[model samples]
Target: MLYNIIFIALFIFVIYVFYKKYSKKAKTIPPHWHSILLKEVAFYKNLEPSEQKRFQDRMMQFLAEVYIDSVDFEIEELDTILIASSAVIPVFSFKEWHYPTVTGIIVYPDHFNEDFEFSNKSESRRIAGVVGTGRLEGKMILSRKALRHGFSNKTDKGNTAIHEFVHLIDKMDDNIDGIPEILMQNMNAIPWLKLVHDKMEAINNDKSDIRAYGGTKQAEFFAVASEYFFERPKLMKRKHPELFKMMAECFRVKF
Candidate 1:
């Protein structure tokens, strides 16, 4: 009985600690920071005033939770704002959602190469951002240049930060297989699978507007599609309505 009491007390203490920690996170944005978002983040301008307020609130919370540290260069205010906004956009619809899988973000000076064993060649590529895995779990690395480019050119269907963050979201279910089980129902799984396959086929045939990189795999497809959905929503909706709808359902947000 004494041991049982101790165990229950410990559990309660842990829960209380977590509650206190998260409850203290900032939920409101300061006016200066709000202006920064207004001037710097293009996506913020796309939202309605009410949504713009929610976006700022969520961004403040994100910045409070996700530690942004510099890799080789000094982290700038715009970097933090843009990074926080990228993190907030995808999960904005789920008020209670936070990226538990991501512990922090590392900002690099520019495109850097990291050795990966994904292929037999063990080749290195100039990467803009990466979501951690295995021993590097709970972390993300992004390039300062790429982050600037993502927000600077709104018409381009690319946003490296969002792409990496989507990968993190895809991994929330303990898997990054492109099909986000957390947001997708089991009954709709097969349909989602079929849709991905069909779109990939069209991409391979050069008949699809989705970036060719998306056709590489299911995981890449999801990330690349998310980049396009958020950056070029109108083009995506007009060219690939079904895929756009699927993305809208998964994100619970309309671009």
Candidate 2:
């Protein structure tokens, strides 16, 4: 009897804490939003019915907490869902995960350059997304067209939003090194580093199937490889089994 009472109390406390975390309480995911998720979001649609509800609740919570605004283009409901979905996919296994580094998201109508200019006339406008620093800290800017393109194609095995969000996750330990100390324990550090180095060599030598950008640096490698992991889990596992396992451990989820 005493144990049962204690268990009930603990359960209630957990629920209360979760409720207090987001007191703003997001509105229900509208029918239109449901349709969008069902049709557009492969990860959400593939989840079990109960898990899909959980995913929706998290999406609503994110939408409530993180304001998505447009710079020069009108964002559709689909765009909003895509942004939130990108944020959710990486940390979905954690019940209380949040993007502490991101305060607001600014979406440009198209690609931008180092100066944040997105006009098509600029030949140097090549950047797809960037996490802010300096005066622009606590903000993330993304190309709306690139954002849509990330999800539109599954064959490329890349998602710019996911890549950027993984960077945020990589920064949680206050270090932007390719090694995510938060996700990687001290014991696994050497193996993870060695594995990263070897794979980077393959990428640099044009022998690996991973993207070439990953070979540029460890931080970029982690983000780029994360994109490949989430977008094409089966292919990654079949080709790079070790990297696949480490990524699964890092995200605490496997597709």
Candidate 3:
């Protein structure tokens, strides 16, 4: 009876700990932040009031969990709001989804070089955003300017924050070669491959609306197409129905 009593007590303790942890995580956001999201992010503005509330909830959860800090420029409310929105948009369809591999986000004042090391001799190319790997895994870097630019205009179908996070998501399957293994069923793999190849070929031939960057590689194609999928759903659907359907299935979101 003593052993049974100890086990019950331990279970109750674990439940209590989890309850408190979750309750603390669900803290409400300030009204001003909601206003900022509405004004700054087109995605947030397009959501219904109820959906807006849900988005805010998810944003708050992300802010609470993710360590967002600035490198050179002072981070503002809008920056965090928009960054969190970018993270939320891709996985918004799944209520319980969270970016497990992404532990933190670093925002630089502007685009940085490949190694991001400031040295006159280093010949690194400037880039907007990059996902961390190797020893620096679980981290992501973004340009503050690019973060704002993503929300400032809704027509470009390009978002640096979303682009990098999609790369992170693509990495979940132990491969970042454009195939999202965990989310896609085995039966759909071949068709997905064919579509990726054909569309990439079209982009190479300049016969596709997908950015030329997508023609670079399979992984780049997935990330670039995802940008179009979320940012310009109508154009994507009208122009390329099959690619749109594939994106929809990959994300489980219609738009």
Candidate 4:
């Protein structure tokens, strides 16, 4: 009985210590609005003062909850990446799935190579890209160069971080076919599939601004669409209204 009481007391003490430490960290972190880093996030700069404040609050909450890797990378650059990513939140606002499945972001100096196995084949192939990969458990790998390109290439219709993050979102329900659970929930899968298929066909026929890579697969289509959706919302709205609407509903933000 004495040993049991001692064990209980130790557990309570440990919990108390952890809570105190967490509280201290929380207190030291300044409010999002005052974060000097926000000045560096390009997208944040484009927003109106009120919208910027809203985004700042959202970003601050995200930083508090998510494990961000700023080491070996400029803090301002990291802030820009996170802010750009957080913009997706408004796009997915109509859905209950706001937070990314990946909670941790690992930034790399540049594009990295990874060996991926092909189905029904014994050989593995090496692939290189800006953002290497992601998982549903809130883990994402980003290439700094790719991230910059995604933001820089307004006409290219490719964003590595957004592409990889979209994959993470699609994997939230443990499936990765370019269709996220939230987008599929209240909508018919056929239309979504058909729209993507048609878009891919149009791309192949040189009828769209989407890159050839976007026509590679349904997953690629989703990622490419995300690039266009964010970088050229007005163009996407004018060219593919339904697709734009679906993406808007998926992200819950107005373009």
Highest-scoring model, lDDT? 2
lDDT of 1 by residue, 1-255 (tens): 999999999999989966755666685666788777877777788778998988888888877776889865688878888999999888888877788787789887777677532233445647889997778788898888899999988678999999999999899888899988888863388888999999998999999878899999999999999999998888999989988998999988766
| Winning model by TM-score | 2
RMSD of each: 3.8, 7.5, 4.6, 7.2
Q: What tens digits encode model 2's per-residue C-alpha lDDT throughout 165-226?
A: 88888888887789877777633788898999999999999999999999999999999999
- In model 1, the runs with Cα more than 4 Å from the true position are 1-17, 116-125
Error of 4 at 248 (Å): 2.3
lDDT at 41, model 2: 75
Candidates in order, TM-scores: namely 0.87, 0.89, 0.86, 0.69
Off by over 4 Å in 2: 1-22, 185-187
Judging by TM-score, tell me the better candidate of 3 and 4: 3
lDDT of 4 by residue, 1-255 (tens): 999999999999989865543443222234554444344444556677777566555554445445656436564545454544543443434322344455566665555455422223424322223233444245566666666666665566566776776776777677778888756687778888999999999999989778788898998888779877777788889988988999887776665
User: Per-model C-alpha lDDT, please?
Assistant: 0.84, 0.87, 0.84, 0.63
Which parts of model 4 are misplaced by more than 4 Å? Answer: 1-48, 70-100, 115-138
- Candidate 4: worst 10 consecutive residues by lDDT? 122-131
The TM-score, computed over Cα atoms with residue i paired to residue i, of candidate 2 is 0.89
